[model samples]
Target: MADKCHMCLLGLIILCPLLTGMNGAETTHVFCSSGENVHLPCNIALSGCTSTTWNYNRHSSAVEMVSGGKKKNDIERHERLSLGSDCSLNIKNTKEDYGSYSCIQYVNGQQQGTDAHVHLHVLHGQCFCKSHV
Candidate 1:
């Protein structure tokens, strides 16, 4: 019984930080196929995306994809990106879109709350075809 309790406590200590950011924001994992469209949720309730900003990072410096609910025209993949009604970041025809995305909300030029982090994992799907002889 003591061993089980200790193991549980150890697990919590090891996993808690990974589950939540330092600011106590929960991280969500989104998995999608390589060539499919994907939605990275903001997980925040808001009337509009006017105060939302989405940043993406893939093993390097973060890039701002959307600012104040508007897509950044200068971004590399801006053509394939759109902001959903619910402030979710939508990426169309996702091929190399796997990365860490963060949604931040600001009001009056100040951050409102904790940022929502999302880790996107893109999997290469395989097709199996059978021949009828």
Candidate 2:
């Protein structure tokens, strides 16, 4: 019985930090309309990041959007993809851009901050017109 108790304690010690780290990360969502610019706020300052990456679609092949200062590279780079002064992601609104976007921040290439998960929901647009009788 004592041996089993010791093993359990050891297991908890090993796993405690892992669990805490995962809990430290956060996930949030945002909604946007098609044909409008959307800001997925990370709220982490640019000065705080040595590296920053945005990932799209949590389950599918994760598409990475890179940005740091004026340097950015990725498919969405041409479409006015930008990071705000506060490190929020600004995406030129489109139906294709609707999905889960995750912002992972790093200091000196070590993940050490709250992660952001922004869900971009693009509402289907409609036009209303009055009938002239």
Candidate 3:
């Protein structure tokens, strides 16, 4: 009976948003078979939050994708990765697009919350190669 209840709870967790609204977690992960999808979690005080932005630094062959937005000044990285307002780092499928990522959140023109960390790991191709051996 306990195991059944635990499973029910897990189901609820995955289905609650579908039944209710588009709610998101304070933290999330993005798994990639060939690439990585990064979700940078951030928050600011409700009283002072006006605008929010994301900043990330990527060095794949020692390159910059995003330095900083118009509001802030920072170094830029390579073009292999893309970023969005939700703080989503969308990287194109590339073997070299794997490394440490620094995620920053800005609110009301002030840095707040924390600097999130994300790491990308590249894996071998399909396991079919092993089967042939």
lDDT of each: 0.77, 0.59, 0.41
Q: Candidate 2 — which residues are off by over 4 angstroms?
A: 1-26, 46-50, 67-72, 126-133
- Per-prediction TM-score to the true structure, in the order listed: 0.76, 0.63, 0.43
Better of 1 and 2 by TM-score: 1
Relative to the true structure, candidate 2 reaches a TM of: 0.63
Clashes per prediction? 0, 0, 6
Model 2 scores a C-alpha lDDT of: 0.59
Error of 3 at 50 (Å): 11
lDDT of 2 by residue, 77-100 (tens): 545787777777777745567777
| CA lDDT for candidate 3 | 0.41
Q: Over the stretch 1-133, how does candidate 1's per-residue lDDT look in tens digits?
A: 5456445445544664576565565677666557787878898737889999999998888999999999999988999999999999989988888888999999999997788888776656532111110
Per-residue C-alpha lDDT of model 3 across residues 1-133, encoded as one tens digit per residue: 5456445445544653354322322222222334433333333323322333444335544333343432332332345455555545555554554455445545555666664544444434431100000
Itemize residue pairs with steric clashes in candidate 1: none
lDDT of 1: 0.77
As a TM-score, model 1 comes out at: 0.76
